[model samples]
Target: MDAAVAAIEESGPSGWSLRELARRAGVSHAAPAHHFGDKTGLLTALAAEGFGLLADALTAAGDGLLDLGVAYVRFAVRHRAYFEVMFRPELYRPDDPELTAARTRADELLGDAVRPLSPEPEAALAAWSIAHGFAGLWLSGALPPEVGTDPEAAARPVLGTLFPYDEDGRPAAEPPRER
Candidate 1:
């Protein structure tokens, strides 16, 4: 897993090959195929692992949406390879059972996190969008330098723009309207 992560991070989704991965891992060329079946299977496994790790991180975020958003960005920055593959279904087999279960776990974590904010199903979607958007930007260094490169420190203020907290640190206004 670590070897795959390193290769993906260094070479991107399309840049790395299974044979190269085996070479990097100091294993036989057929080792990765034997373990994961093929490149797609390897990527699928990576995505599943990434989602599972994301779920764990988000679950560990014990605060409100801001905290969860921060965790999301942090996870993306921390697990660049997994985070990258998790969203690129074409890079892996979307119908894989383990992949589906892992993705579901991550989705359920976000859904549960947003449940208390609103009964509207869209709330979960909005929460995910904002967090993911910010995280992606942060990962790409698209965020301005003023926001700082630190994921957690930068996330509080930026995410707060979408879900501002009052002086008492409670969610401001009317539960943050999406439309």
Candidate 2:
């Protein structure tokens, strides 16, 4: 797994080959195929691992949507290789069982984290979209350099407005809208 991570990080989804991976790990060229079946299999495993890490990090952050956003950016920075493949379904097999399970687990984690703050089911989806959008912006270098200096800190003020919170730091209830 470490070898796969290293190769993906250094090159990208398409850059690494099984032979080079075997060379780095001091194993025969067939070793990776035996373990992962192929490049897609390897990437699927990597995405699963990445999703697990994301779940743990988001759970630990405890800042609700804000913390989840921070964790998303942190995950990208911390696991650039995994992050690169986790979202690129074309790079690997989308139907892989492990990848499917991992994607489900990650989505569930996001749902659990955002559900409480949402007044309606759609609200949870909206919250997740916003958080993910912010994280994507950060990962894509769209945020200003100062924002990147301390991503969490810089993002807080903007995200705070997007997801209103009370003085206690919990998300505030949404107000009534026009009928």
In terms of TM-score, the best-performing candidate is: 1
The local distance difference test score of model 1 is: 0.83
Question: Where does candidate 1 have its weakest 10-residue lDDT segment?
Answer: 167-176
lDDT of 2 by residue, 1-179 (tens): 78888887777778878889999999999999999999888888888888888777877877567667667767777778888888888878888777788777777777776776654768667666676677678767887777657766766676666567776546778832434
RMSD in Å for model 2? 2.5
TM-score of each: 0.91, 0.85
- Candidate 2 regions exceeding 4 Å error are 119-121, 173-179
Alpha-carbon error at 115 in model 2, in Å?
2.1
Q: Pull out the clashing pairs in model 2.
A: none
Q: In candidate 2, residue 124 scores what lDDT?
A: 61
User: What is the TM-score (0 to 1) of candidate 1?
Assistant: 0.91
List model 1 lDDT by residue over 1-179, tens digit each.
67889988898887888899999899999999999998899999999888889988988986577778888889998899898899999999999888899889888877876776677788888889888998888888888888865788877777777666775435666676666
Global CA lDDT computed for model 2? 0.76
Every candidate's CA RMSD:
2.0, 2.5
C-alpha lDDT values of all predictions:
0.83, 0.76
